[model samples]
Target: MAGEEGKIDPMHQFEIQPIFDGGFEIAGQTINFTNSALWMILTFITLWIFMLGGMKREIIPGRWQVMVESMSNFVTNMLTSNVGEAGRKYVPYVFSLFMFILFANILGMLPIGVIGLHPFTVTSHIAITGILAVLSFSIVLIVGFWKHGLHFFSLFVPHGTPLPMVPFIAVIEFISFMIRPFSLGLRLFVAMTAGHVLLKVLGGFVINSTNAGAGYGALVGIPSFMLMVGISALELLVAVIQAYVFALLTSLYINDAENLH
Candidate 1:
């Protein structure tokens, strides 16, 4: 929570403050390193280290290798179940996407504020999530057209329908298909941001109530702190579920492209 003079600002965590005073300017656009970029880089580094450690290939696997293998199998099963044989080639892409989002979400929820470090959730921003959604959607489009050429347009039309209704149905289907990226990105962004905002608000309640007196501490602060604990657990669940949902939906969309259903 960010505030001055005892005021609370729940949305302050989402702000992307620059680490440097000024950065390189190119083509009339200024690009500077910010907290968001730092967190993203950290996410990548952490993931790399974890993966590297897990790839030691011991004759008898350790817990670290077990975890890596389990997650890899999970992603592989998700893709194969949804996209079938052709999806094997896309495993690398989908697994990377899932792990990146999962780690980013988990890193944001770490209680590092006690250590004077701020944890930034990259997925909480629509801009970041939107890019991810677009990248997945782009793969779908590219695969569809590359494999089927003009026949890919048939995706907007169902298998069998009345000739006259085909035009109207196709138009509606096209609009819905186009909305996937926005909805996909918005879902993850909203879920992550809303949970953080709620937690921040509850944190404010706990602080203010405890500061008031013994009565307020018992009545408000205690309850608020308990609720925050529960919500934090729920937020962790949401992080994992969101990552799975994202990967699952990407596979399903890829299925449509690969099989043209």
Candidate 2:
């Protein structure tokens, strides 16, 4: 049991478990809800509770109210800057995306794994991120075509390119546009997965060190613990940054589609 207790499986943390086994089915397909769904719902609810609870008419805002306002303004500024005046209409969707991702990333960093809890991060799964990316990309596509019609295709073709290079450049642009969803999703998935794995490795070392008794364990364990502390801080920064980057990139994509430059 000691040997088993010392064992660590980093990838095991990403596994998805159904919340209800005997879930409903549709057309012979088992439609079971999962931890990912649960967490996503929780993230949304958390965002709503914070925002709703914080909103009140006051001369001086409280901490939660200030945070809510700050977060709203931050995302609003990002969209307005990147996507311009037209982006105001999209503030709702973009803000929700930002909040969901930010919360999910933070949730992933919780040390529930050490306590034998079935912790999970939905953003760690490519399926979740991929769907989000695709949805964002689809919105861009639909809006672009709706506003610009066939001229939206001009997005792939450069304005001042020579005839000979036009085809090649257009092909390259097409490929890059097509890869947006893939890249966006993969970026989030990889960041969450890799960060957790590294944290788990260091965490496991900490636990294993304690099991090894004293003596040399202290020499190795102290440094690992310190490094883990640093890593945890860095991970928190990364979680916030990744969410910002995702939203920023998405805003830029929207700009590209809208103006077709």
Candidate 3:
């Protein structure tokens, strides 16, 4: 009976109205700040503090150092297991990507309204994810070519494939490689956007039903609240998983380019 529209708009929960408007005279470019920018800035600052604070070389590990080390080790192991020892060189970029996404995801969970600001999520923006995906893809492309030269193209051709199927296989491989950026970006964007929308819709239903003095509203509201809590926890996990997956896949692609296997 609730959420009967079967479609919920999560954008309503966050205020995305533009705060500044400026047009560049030389380049003919327009720039404006929005709630999304505020959240992104917050995410960046949070990441900087957490990471920079723990960057000191300590003989005995502090809590912050241990936290940083754990995350680094996690990415290191993931890379080594998937891409071997040669992949260690990519740990810095991979770790940076993971920390950025992790911070964005966690910050979005906070109630920004408490600080008198709009609650906008970085992951909800396709453009943001697209940019990150492009960066990752670019790194993979550059590193692949740098490490293997023209041999990187050989990744499209499988060694065991028959000659007749080579052209078709190569085309498919190329297309799939090209699609990686869009696929990776869209997956994170859609998942975060959809989860937030679901929570907002459920919260709205509970509030409206309660105002109407509907006796059943309490039952529905309680469960809806619980569902929201569960989703928040799940989103935290999804955030880390998405980042790890992105880094892991990038390493794998690099490995393919290097070994041509």
Runs off by more than 4 Å, candidate 3: 1-9, 20-26, 114-116
Summarize candidate 3's per-residue lDDT along 1-261 as a digit string, tens digits.
Answer: 132454435567554656677523446644557768778898889988988867896989899999988888998997788788977887888888878877887788676555775567787778888998888888778877988898888888888899999999999999999999899788878877877777677767667656657676776777877887887788778767776776777777667755568
RMSD of 1: 1.2
- Give per-residue CA lDDT, model 2, range 1-261, as digits (tens): 122556878777787778888888899977779888888887888778878956884669888788888888988998898888998888888888888899999977777756776667889999989999998999899999999999999999878989999889999999999999999999999998898889878777877887788754697777888999999999899899889888988888888878889
lDDT of 1 by residue, 1-261 (tens): 547877778898999999988899999988889999999999999999999878989979999999998999999998888889898988999999999999999999999988988889999999999999999999999999999999999999998878999999999999999999998999999999999999999999988888788899999999999999999999999999998899988999999999998
Q: Given candidate 1, what's the lDDT at residue 198?
A: 97
lDDT of each: 0.93, 0.85, 0.77
Pull out the clashing pairs in model 3: none
Question: TM-scores for all candidates?
Answer: 0.96, 0.92, 0.87
Which runs in model 1 stand beyond 4 Å of their true positions? none
Query: Sorted on lDDT, highest at the top, how do the candidates line up?
Result: 1, 2, 3
- Count of backbone collisions in candidate 1: 0
Q: Evaluate model 2: give its TM-score.
A: 0.92
Whichever of 1 and 2 has more TM-score, that candidate is 1
**Against the correct fold, how does model 3 do in TM-score?**
0.87
